[model samples]
Target: MGDFVLSGNVTRRENKLIPHWKGPHRVVVTNNGWTYDVQEFVAPFAIITRHIMRLKIFRDKYLGVTEDLWEYATYANGGHMVQRFLDCKMKFDTHQWEVLVQWRGLDEAENSWEPARILLEDFPLLLARWVRTDAKAEGMRSFVLNETSSRRGK
Candidate 1:
């Protein structure tokens, strides 16, 4: 039941030219062979469930690398799509602004700081959204920070 398997059309497809199967997901529930529940995450939870007929046993080609990433979330030239901008900072030497980019399908810890100039050029809309975020204008006492270790999601 722990073996990975390739999946069929679990999600709706916009383009018909994509690959037929996109996963080698770990089987979470066998469902007695009628239906199987598969999880693509390293975390312990099932994200997809499909009938047995739409699945095929998968064999790993590379050792220790098995996560089936977002086959449909990349940009045209295989670039990572930014989910959002989480933080902002000024570069120490260049004095240029940088924003922390939260990539699609990745966790918060995987986020990275990118040049604001580049982002403003590549993704102006995203940079605009980040600029419009509440501004953390705590100087006006409307928003609070450093009050506690707990914080809400953006």
Candidate 2:
């Protein structure tokens, strides 16, 4: 088997509005009909088997498109590249909140989800924005609900 990238699922955190095409993982084994065992280098280097439907052939075009993705890959490959942060958000997850980031020189299509601790340490301003946006959204939602209830009572 060769190195292949894993496709992201639509339900992944911060991926709801974006395409999920993450990976370049090394293939550990190949199964029947486009399935392969792959390795994820994040954190503790976990191995996962994925179907060919979710895998793509790694290409050079995928690189240099976004700084965060490229830098993370470089680091994972034992290279050093300075990462620049552009924007951040706190996204609600099933169990907890997560940090979604927008990297410099990359559009909305390139923004990816990160851990909240990384935002706190590297980009506090984005964290503040996330808080403000959350508050504004909550306020608007409350106002709408109140108006609807009042109309129903009339």
- Best candidate (score: lDDT): 1
Record all residue pairs in model 2 with backbone atoms less than 3 Å apart, i.e. clashing.
5-24, 8-20, 34-52
lDDT of 1: 0.57
Ten contiguous residues with the weakest lDDT in model 2: 79-88
Superposed model 2: Cα runs more than 4 Å off: 12-19, 61-71, 74-105, 108-154
Q: Which residue runs does candidate 1 get wrong by more than 4 Å? A: 1-77, 136-154
lDDT tens per residue, model 2, 1-154: 7555755445546644455555557688877776778876454567887777777776554243344343445453552222333333335454423444555446778667666554443433334334445653342233334444564477
Clashes of 2: 3
For residue 137, give model 2's deviation from the true position in Å.
Answer: 44
